[model samples]
Target: MSGETNRLLGMAKEIMAQPDGRELDMLASTGEQVSVALLAIALQALGKQAVSYAGWQVPIKTDSAFTKARIRSIDDAKVRKDLNAGKIVMITGFQGVDADGNITTLGRGGSDTSAVAVAAAIKAAECLIYTDVDGVYTTDPRVVSDARRLKTVTFEEMLEMASLGSKVLQIRSVEFAGNYKMPTRVLSSLTDPLTPLAEEAASGTLISFEEDKNMEQATITGIAFSRDEAKITVLGVPDRPGIAYQILGPVADANIEVDMIIQNQSVEGKTDFTFTVPRAEYAKAVEVLNSSVKAHIGAAAINGDTKVSKVSVVGVGMRSHVGIASQMFRTLSEEGVNIQMISTSEIKISVLIDEKYMELAVRALHKAFDLDSAK
Candidate 1:
């Protein structure tokens, strides 16, 4: 697949032409279609009654967004009927069609989201995700040698971890599963699927609601980190009402997401505002803020750094716990790591620091929180 995609892209580059989102989507969707057809063929060869359905055939409806379409609804009648008829129904995972009958593809990690959406539409018992890893780990196993696989994790924790850059599950899919109250399991595709379904499930990590007993045992469920962050600061802005909006309006209009915002106290009626955006959007965000935003909002200068990282500790038990924040600060301080910006929610606390300290911060925090062992 990689070779094929590279070849396709190389040809496009040679032609000195750029493919629009719609064309890119159309081309990218063929990969999933091919996989579904091959899988269906393999199933039939194994003596199973099997059939393959494209997204348009199953009718996974999504918005008109060409490359990053969002699923609006799905028609499950075909799949249901096929299942009742004792035939396996295989649907292409990521691509869908809009109302105008235009092909659309979801962006990165869309396949996982598509699977969850289908499960939700059909009211399945659970959605099992077959990935390269057997289960969610306390941290990236390659980074932390002692990282342990979790038996179960609350949806809140999983959502936070995913948003904080844990790649075990896609953040949108986790949110969809949570919204539909669907049980999800993470299992490895490298393992033999012939294992009894029940036994196989036990070997994976179950994502459940916070009311479960297992969810209340840990204040910090795991450590998540991402290096794809950049910080931007708008300095010397008047500390008047709606200043935040004045500074961030253009950024939002440009479709750039702002994360980990900090507004310092007014100093001589002026304040320094700092925030973070995805590294890819760093230049665009800075440009948006510097062009008209600085003058309109009465700001002095704009500064940005692309070499920043965010690390977070996430858990449902955080709600009932105390001293977790202080302990986190102390742990990082002991490591001689300086925190740049901080953001917190009910389930997570994320801090931005120099990118160079990302791994050291994760390892230190993991050890400090005792995340290498299961609760």
Candidate 2:
């Protein structure tokens, strides 16, 4: 698949042209279509009725954002028709069609998002997402040797974990499942094929809408870290009306997602404003500010750090427990890890720090909050 993308890119380079997002989608979508067709063929080889369909055939509708499309809705009539006929309907994920009939892909973890959306559309009782790992863990196993796999997690906590950096589930999938109150389970793709259906179904971490009272709650459920973080500061801007919008509006228009915003107190009617964006968009975001916003906003200068990372502690138990942030800060403070930025929500607390200190921060915080021993 990447070979095909590269071929297209190489052709474009020869013609002195950049690959258009639309054409890129047209090429990248072929990969998923191939997988679906092969799966359908394999199922048919077993003497089971099966059919394969592309996103446009399933008509999974989405906004025409090209590379980073959003699922607007999905038409399940064809899928239901095939299923009612006792055929296994295999459809491509990650890519969908727009009202104008153009193919578009959901960003990096689109497959999971597509699955959850389709499940909700068809009113499926539950959606199981099969991945490389057995289930969601306290943290990445490579990062923490004793990281434990969770049997179940509230949708709220999972959402925070996904957004913070847990790769077991994509953030949008968690958001979709939570929004629709849909039951989603993360299962291991490497499970034995002959395992009992009942036993297999009960395996993995269930992202449930309700907390399991039978399980003891921990103040911190997991440690999530993102090395793909970058922070940008619009320094010395006027502390007046619409200032935040003035700084961030163009950024939004550029389709660069911003996170963890901070505004310092007004000093003589001027303040320092800072926000974080994905590391990949760091340069583009800085370019956007320099060319259009800098002089207009009369700011001192635009500064950014592409080598930063975000580490977070997420848990629903924080609503009842206190000192989570204090403990987190103290833990980092003791490790001499300097936090560059801070953001918090009811169920989570995230800190942006030097990228080099990310692992040290995660290990220390994981142990400090007793996540290593958390069930």
Candidate 3:
């Protein structure tokens, strides 16, 4: 798939000086269209009734964002009709039509978002996401040999993990499912589809509300880590009202995301502010700050480092537990790892660390929190 995209990108570069977003979406959407058509044909060859439909045919309406459209609404009239007629219907994913009828493709991994949106529109009982891994784990199994498969996880924990870098499901899809209270299962595509539903439930992890009594009770559900993080610090800024906004407003205006912001305790009348951004945007964010933001805000200097990563411990049980944060800090310190910045929410604690120690921090935290033994 990546090779095909690269080939198309090369062709576009050769054919046009600069391809517009609309044109790019139009070209990229053909990939999903072809996939659904081929899959439909394969099913028909097996003597089953199957049909393929494009996003416009089923009318998955989205905003006119071109390459990163958000689903505005989905009209299931044609889908329901086709299913009622005893035919298995397949629709192209990752592409939707705007109200203006222009072809728009969702961003990378938008197919997962499209599937979840459709399931919500139809009010399906459960949306099973079949992937290479059997289910969500205590940690990345490749990183930890004993990373156990979770039978069930609360939506809050799943959200934290997905956003922090578990990558089993798209973060937006998880948010959409949680909003509508949709049940999603992450199971292996290698399993037989004809298996009984009740028996198959044990093969994958179920993401449900915390109200589920069967959810495994644990202080820390998992440790998630993300690399390619860069830190930026603005030094000697007046510690007054709206100082944060003054420093970050330009980055936001330029569409650069800021994460894990921390302001040092005020010293005299000034303080130092620090934050992290994706490594790809680190240079751009620094340029924005150094160019004028520093002088305008009366800050002394700006500094940045691109060799950082974030580690987070997530669990719904943390809301009612004590000492989780201290335990996490102690575990990292005992492993000779240093925390660069810290951020926390009700159910999660995240810290920025040197990228080189990311694996060490995750492994130490996993064992410290007893995640390896979690059911």
Candidate 4:
């Protein structure tokens, strides 16, 4: 409660306004409402008239899902009326109203989504996302301090990074910006006012279309690592049509995501199948499969290991590149990184490696692909 009070006070100060005890108590939905109000006050202090509004006030209507609600529509008439009234409208980013007329909150960092949605609705020239970091880095700075910051990145690359584990931006926000062709700039909130918003500046990364003609699209963009993986192996199942479905249907019904499936050729009319799932759901997955499929298929047993990690190299450039997979395997092999399983998409090649080797594997791949260089 004290933390929330201090946050509201700080926001009020930034906006050059005295803290409103009543409004704070009634209107505060998330920390972002305070931020919007503060920003509005700052704009007002700069001689611009600004109006702060909450999600309920703006009435950003969304689905019934709380804490991850998808925006169904925005009552643009209300927004246009306010903007035309010479008011710089400030709105809470991640919260919305559901069909049941209930207030819903979009999950973590949904502010980015809110900002882009506003930009699209208002047809703004650009959307600027301010954050603590100057720009996206080649690798996490904490893990690789020398990781260089990228001046600019394409939407495809940004999406891949966000899905892979880059915390700089959210994936849905990027998708929204790209779909509308709304120019987006990511810059440090702490940077000096004189710093330009171009990719050449030490400001945040600019996510936009690439214009270079000779930039050799590499097979891999950057290495992404995740430790939330588990392996499930079903041994000695009868090899026949529809057997795979029989084994995986229940798992899917239970909403467990299965990744990197491998099935061996039939040996004496039986086959061993293996796949990966999120570690947190491994036990439920195993139990479901063992109970439902084991007796029917006369399989040997169900087994799993929750201590595995997944690392991948993602880049749309890989569509035209050859031998990238070979190079990646060779590099990891040189480092003695034992790969347990492998999977690939047209743009990404992922491998399951021991959790202990994650850092070394990423560093090795970073060097091998020359990712730290300013290519």
Candidate 5:
């Protein structure tokens, strides 16, 4: 799939100076289009009536954001009609069309988002997401061998984990399911072809709205880590009102998202500000600030580190638990992992750490929280 996108990208560059977002989405969406067509063919060969449709065909209307489009609404009438006619319907994921009839794509986990959105639109009983891994784990299984497959996780915890780095399901999909109270399951696609329906129904991780009574209120439900983070610091800025906006406004104007921001206490009326961005946008963010913001704010030099990563512990128990923060810091400290910045919410605690210690930090946190199934 990536090979196809890359080939199109190369072709575009050769044929034109640079590919615009509209064409980029037009090119990228073909990947899903091809898959749906093949699946429809396979089903037909198996003696089942089936049909495939693309986003524009269904006219899944989206805002005109081009590559990063958000689904405004999904017209499920066509899918329902196909299903009513006794035909299996396959709809392309990750791509939608605008009212202007321009093709757009939801960024990153857009396919998962598409699936959930469609399920909600059709008011399905549940949405089953089949993926490579069997289900969501306490952490990346490769980093922590004993990471447990959660039978069920609360919707909120899953949201935090997905945003933090538990990539079993993307955060946007979870958000969609949560908003509409949709029951979404993540199960493996590798199950036996003829697995019993009852058994398959009970397998995988169920993401629900706190509907699982057996879910333990573990202080740390999971350890989440992401290496795709970069930190930027603006030094020696006046600690006055709106200073933050003065610094971040331009970055936002440039479409750079900021996360885990910190501002040191004023020292002689000046403070240092720091924040994190997706590593891919770090260079562009710095350039935006330097070009349009720095001198206007009368700040000192700006610097960034693309080698940093973020580690977070996510659980609903954090709201009522004590010592969670201290224990998390202690675990990382014992592993020689230094925390650069910190962010927190009712269900999670996030800390920026040197990229080299990311896996080490995750492993230590997993052990500290006793999330190991073998234990």
Candidate 6:
């Protein structure tokens, strides 16, 4: 159990005045309900009324997928009735039900989703998310030591950052906050509890819908890297319509997510195609493609490489700027870093470089973007 979980549990016990009480757990509808119940007891000690409720109890309805359930609607009347009756609701995040009434959970980090849902249901003025980090930094502090904490961040920029992989806040939570127009504060729970609430400054990032013009913009927002990638090569597929589909169909059926695909024109009426997928699914994808598509396309062979990483430069400012990608490529070239593949979005640019060059590449790009400088 984490310290925060333990503290909440201890607080629940103190408030309840009973070692064991009827607690509701709003868990991920997966398993975090155990932690919720434990925390309820801790809340009791602090003289705060507490109860843990699962997504089913709070009945956060959504689609029936167990791991990545999407919430459909919440019956807030029951929640409001409980809160009005003096109950501190500890509901689970990440799982809900569907019209057919099946248990589903939002994917990973759904706990943040649960927090925002509860806040919105109760119309709380602010939703404070306590995490390990003190707050949101100008850039990832681990990458840029001088990365300063932002008092606030706009919803759109934060969404782009989170989607690009700033794990401080879940993308869904930010979306929920923006939709509800709620002010969400991300704080570190590690701060001293004895300090006055006002004096206990929030150390992490605060995400809101408004932007601060006074806050100078950094050319790059942060550095995000992912190693969960695998490259796939399909040799000698006929140059024709639906060939790409015929090749990728089985991989999709096998639930492998393909990324960064490239198909070159056929040489002598036979073309070569390549793409990437999650490293874990590499074997399955290759197996399916080799077994099914290979014979159909007269493919010579299927090849897979799991030892690759995608490092990206993310910033909303890039939308208005030119030469960002060129500068990134130049910096990597100057460092003798060879890029294997490349991908880009309006707000982000990602390149697949040698895994060995991951850190060196990130540092070079960070410096090139002037992210290490104080704004």
The number of the candidate with the highest TM-score is 3
Encode model 6's per-residue lDDT on 22-43: one tens digit a residue.
1312222435677678788899
TM-score of each: 0.93, 0.88, 0.94, 0.81, 0.91, 0.80
Q: What is candidate 2's local distance difference test score?
A: 0.87
Q: Which digits, one per residue and each the tens of the lDDT, describe model 3 over residues 1-375?
A: 436655775788898978898998888788778878888999999998898888888889999998889888999887787777988888888889998899998887787788888888877778888788889988888887878888888888899888888999989888878987888889998888799878886679989755846334545779888888999999999999999999999999989988899999999999999999989999899999988599899998998889999999998767456688888889999999989999989889999999999988888888887778855
Pitting candidate 2 against candidate 6, the one with the higher TM-score is 2
Query: Residue-pair clashes per candidate, as listed?
Result: 0, 0, 0, 1, 0, 41
Error at 183, model 1, angstroms: 1.2
lDDT of each structure? 0.86, 0.87, 0.86, 0.78, 0.88, 0.74
lDDT of 5 by residue, 1-375 (tens): 447666766787888886799998999889889889999999999999999999999878899998889999999899988888999888889899998898999988898999999999889988999998899899999988989988877899889888887888888999999998899999999999799978998999999776545334545679888889999999999889999999999999888888899999899999999999999998899999889888998989898899999989998868566688999999888888888998989888999999999988998999898899542
Report the CA-based lDDT of candidate 4 relative to the real structure: 0.78
lDDT (Cα) of model 5: 0.88
Candidate 1 is scored at a TM of 0.93
Query: Which sections of candidate 3 miss by over 4 Å?
Result: 1-6, 16-18, 192-201, 214-218
- Candidate whose lDDT is highest: 5
Q: Which run of 10 residues does model 5 get worst, by summed lDDT?
A: 210-219
What is residue 37's positional error in candidate 2, in angstroms? 2.1
**CA error at residue 118 for candidate 4, angstroms:** 2.1
Q: Please, what are the lDDT tens digits per residue for candidate 1 over residues 164-228?
A: 88788888889889988888999898888688878887887889764747545546778988889
